[model samples]
Target: MANPADGTVCNGKLHNHQKQSNGSQSGNHKRNGIIRETQQNGKPYFYNKPFVESFEKVPMYLAIFTNLSYGIGTLFGYLRDFLRKHGIEKCNMAVERKEQNDFVPLYQDFENFYTRNIYMRIRDSWNRPICSVPGPTFDVMERVSDDYNWTFKFTGRIIQDVINVGSYNYLGFAEKSDESLTTVRNVLMKYGAGVCSSRQEMGHIDKHEELENLVAQFLGVEAAMVFGMGFATNSMNIPALVGKGCLILSDELNHASIVLGARLSKATIRTFKHNNMKNLEKLLREAVIYGQPRSRRAWKKILILVEGIFSMEGSIVRLPEIIALKKKYKAYLYMDEAHSIGSLGPRGQGVVDYFGLDPCDVDVLMGTFTKSFGAAGGYIAGRKDLVDYLRVHSYGAVYATSMSAPIAEQIIRSMKCLMGLDGTTNGMQRVRQLAQNTRYFRSRLNEMGFIIYGNQDSPVVPLLLCLPSKVAAFARILLKRKIGVVVVGFPATPLVAARARFCMSSSHTREMLDTVLKEVDEIGNNLSVKYSRHKKSACPELLDETSFELED
Candidate 1:
């Protein structure tokens, strides 16, 4: 793969480039600067190869209805925009300031249009303020829009005992419980609320080191580094690992943090279909054979990026295959175990543990403490050299404020509980409980003939609702039933793939789950959302696009 070119630089080293052929230069040759090139596995324009759907089982009727909904919405939106521009109607949202009219407009017209014409109608379904801790159940502060969601006023009312399937409480550490609060309280008294400085400065404390060491031990890595922010952990450290001439092969459905990190690195990025091993292998093979674009110089590095458990689709990464591919192609691997850690595997060590794979096989192990750990901040763990390098080079380590002492203590305490080092099996019990909840919930949803996405064992469950209107209705109906849910549509997922995502937690009892199931069954019947009779496979070949259900 690192075949040297004739007089070209690859990986900061000079190599000899291939000699130009004596044949007359064609237009393509002149533009590409290659002479008499031969194809190894067909032409080098591998991306031009036919796009294959990873999961093509979306019912034909659902697809048609979804498109029709968007089509009608867009047409109305345009008509409204034209009328507003012609002074026939007033645009109540995102009014450009009189003074700022001279300057560039704050928002583009399209964004303002989407906000005003589309999102505002369903705005109440999202970002609902909660008054209680986001545990098994929470209190949602009720509000009503005065002018079609353009403005809102609190109703001076709270929806009590709303079952929470929205927050990522995972192992239920986020709940204010007695298990870790005492330790957190002690640390807060000892170190105060804020570190107030970066780790490179005066923010480094005994707790930080203690946490890092504990994290290293937990992940079975040589060392570990902690960051104050979860998103920054990916955005900042990725650039530190690869840049410029390096290549990033990312999953198309990767989280925004990974996307931002890849873009910031300035690496040549190419996405493979989500969880499609065949597509990924094709890209890797083509990349190895063709090397860099046009110049054909070897890439400085090739990094395959994936998530342990995709938050949106709720699918677990094919860790073993990905690791094998990385090894076969001599590429590096980076895994973000944000949702997987403390929620999966026999030991809750994450996807690595889930698949019974070696942790050392992954070059960069990244994760957040926010999800399962019920604490703030993130971490990167691997070899001691990698952690040492990040200590000096990572922007998060150098610039961002250090993690608060109490947060570190919380992670350390929770991690100890998880590892049974706290002299109890409470942590393991939580893991087992979470797994059981996941299986039971997913099986019930499937049995109810609801089209769901993700692995059966994953705690993050997404129930598909094809239309935007359905997304709004689903959340609203659930709220009325005293259950808080998170519904996503449009930009967050495919327009046809709007969904309500439920996060299962150990704190949730069997009664709570049964209540959710009963409510969902009634809602499904009312909204006609249970439109599938069979569970479709995620594999491309087994997909049955024509299969659909009609309500009796």
Candidate 2:
């Protein structure tokens, strides 16, 4: 049988070459165990008998036909390129002569051609306005403030000095402390900057080990392993723990890194509704039914993944309920406390600590030093065996270069300062101030008719604008007023859920909050957008109520 589409033999091994009318064989010939053909110049050509025999003996004739098709394709490609070059040159000359004031005719012709071809259609798919409007340009950020009031330089524009309401420095550690800088400088002098190698290849420094130990102790875990960066820690750790026959039950709103890690592991991943324990239970039951059973090697393990605090939504995970469900299913649990650590709990020990839950019960606790510690890198705290296993086997930790010595040292100092004797007192004070600021900002924003999301205690507050274009416009208005805030739209969140995300900080003063709320109120009124409040509170309130005082 032959394929009519490309002159390929479909069922048989031999290719049929039609004899020419000149009493000579034309095109390529195949007969018995030999291939003979006439060249374009009319010369006769012969192919090896063994080669012909082997080629003819192939079970699928489609391969030979494919090669013929490829040759024809190449010829067409060349002709197309040649024609395009000539056509484009001619078009350019014609347009230059006829269209000094307008390119309407040229544009119409392009549109016609673009719609007619599948490849062209796909190539121009991104040309449409998917988003509402363009975001604030660098040209708009021209102002630089000497005073530490909330102001960001956009473009070359000098906007007014607005209060800073959109920074993630929860404890105000970035501005108030020279401790991290001092530690980094000292470590750099002692260790000479970067370690310049992966952990497995002499990248391990004393400070790195010390910091890991400090993190483990702070989190109340048995052991800990550090990574060069936070993203790598989350992305690499998830894949290292689950693979093949294993099933991963992830929260739908888990960080992108966790999603990528689960994807790379090639595990059976089922996403429960965001923060919905019932959905999780349903998925777990289904997983048990479909998962591998019997032999230890064949039996699959179930891993539950969640974030301590969602970065975008500013919601806290219901750890107690989740733990109960995990225990019932005999599943492992992994928590990314990236945003929670140094921002939650009685002493800023994070969500697990806030609930007074036993650290041993939690299978894995991971956190980053970028936010609260005002440093870089990430760490995973777990049982000794797990940490040891990952240290040797984790792809990202093993292959990627380790954190620089100065960075590691700075993190160590920051951790020690955070967990020291006065740490509890200082941390509590910062948490209180942050809570006060958050409450004040939220209360004022709500009164002014602005919609807010996430837990009330959370520093992250999102002002919903709904339209992607409005989100960008709102950000520009805030920028013009000399306020720095981030506008999150499409891909980061759903198109319809576009918003302006504000990260409140303890470093912010009462006056700053007042000023920011005023601006927000004015903007909302001008835009005629109705605002609402959606606040959720966390449990196990701290006992030290008079630990700190808020600065005016």
Candidate 3:
């Protein structure tokens, strides 16, 4: 296979490029007679162009068996519920609140039923606790359950050196020993663990100002503000930006935090198909021309919400198209780069940089430090006026405590490293290595005929397991073999699209990936999850046919 670090396929040629220069601005550039330039960025950078591909068709036997498993489970679940209601059987989980009988139950009936029946059986596959830093390998605290995942007790067994493909430690910064940690330790000693008050009160420390400045410079924005919590960064600031009269055109599969924020804003919300630019443009046109419901009045403003890399499906957003649509419709754009920043782009600057699009084009650039930086907190970077307005109006800034000192230091250090401000090429090397690792691993999985989802460049790889039972089995079996993975089913995704998501990190070496491939190949063979009927694995070269481009 062609070296992934040599860049992706563009116009049927391998497009390798150089590192970004500090003094560079968005413009056109050419190298090796290839028009390696974007309309926004003059500097040459690798661009992973988006492509359209469908999920592998489920095999007939697998589909039947999967449906049968759920069918039998549901039948028994209802039967057991009936027996318990009739007092013929006891429900150990039932709460006996005699005095509260007149009060309404807090849980929804269907949700409660699903949790007790379907979810409980497969719960062990998720939320597995680890004792060490979430690097390529970590120590998971072993546990035992007496009631089939309803309750658990520690087994006092530590599974050491388990390969972790579950975490969002993309750049491998989530490690115990690193220069970032040194900076964090120094800050902790100087400033203590946290600021006890809100930024509006006494919580605004020098670290906050420094971090915000660094963040603005890093993101190429006029200004930026930090929040103590990642979720709150979206859930709080979005409301402050738009309110009741405004409209939010959101991606259907947006993160829960975005959904919560939109709901809290009390804005008129509409969803379009995931990454469908045509649908997005249609919505934008409708919002602009048709106006608000009932009153038929023009809405105050419209905000299009999307993510850099979708967390579950492993899809990268169609950014250039979205930007074009945003400009065409005159609507504001809010991009959540929770999973993208520090993991993408030649410079690790997220999707905007990946596409060589001007950061200013995105009305709001929001991201968290948790994933790539291996730190806590989030930030919103944009025009000075917008950030200034948010500082006073956003609940996270006015009411919530400022980012912790050590966390701010961690972000500062990592951001510097990613931007090559640390006077070392280590950051760029990590970026290239991560790209290489992601492509190589993805190619191998495709070769194994294990159906995978999302863009080929995305670090998040979701291998289709198809059945909830298979999801559980895949995770449990992997864990037993000293590999840590995360599986999702039901509420997190469509019930039928059950999958095990493997997050790639720069920390993962080729040997580690090969080990995972060998074990997964064996397990897949056993579970019959290799449903792809494609002939590409045998041919090998077809895997590199995915697209990459620079929009002029």
Candidate 3 lDDT at 429 equals 82
- Expressed as tens digits, the lDDT of each residue in 1-552 for candidate 1 is 122211111122111111113322221222112121212133221111222112224677899999999899999999988998788987776667778888888778886666678888998996778988888999999999878887889999999999999999999998786655998998899899999999999999999999998898888778999999999999999999999899999999999999999999999999998887889999999989999998999998999999999998888887767887887899999999999999877678888666545577899999999999988999999999999999999999999999999999989988999988899998988987887787677767776768777765689999988888999999999999998889988888988888899999999998999999999989998999986656433222212222111111
Number of backbone collisions per candidate: 6, 12, 4
Candidate with more favorable, higher lDDT: 1 or 3 = 3
lDDT tens readout by residue for model 2, 1-552: 323322212222112222232445345433222222332233222111111000011113433443454456447545654565577422221234344546435434343331222222122111111111111111222433332212224344333444445555676666423553776787788899778899888888788778887777777677898888899898887888889889888999899889999999899788998777789999877666655544334337899999988888777776767887887788999999899998876557787655445566689988888787767788898799999989877987789999998778767766666665334466556666776676666656655655565665567787767543355567667766756676664456753455678877767777777777788778887875443422221111221243223321
Span of 10 residues, lowest total lDDT, candidate 3:
1-10
Question: To one decimal, what is the Cα RMSD in angstroms of model 2 from the true structure?
Answer: 26.5
lDDT of 3 by residue, 161-248 (tens): 9998989999998888854488789889999997999999999999999999888887777889999999999999999999988999
TM-score of 2: 0.68
TM-score of 1: 0.86
Best by TM-score: 3
lDDT of 1: 0.81
Q: Cα lDDT for residue 495, model 3?
A: 61
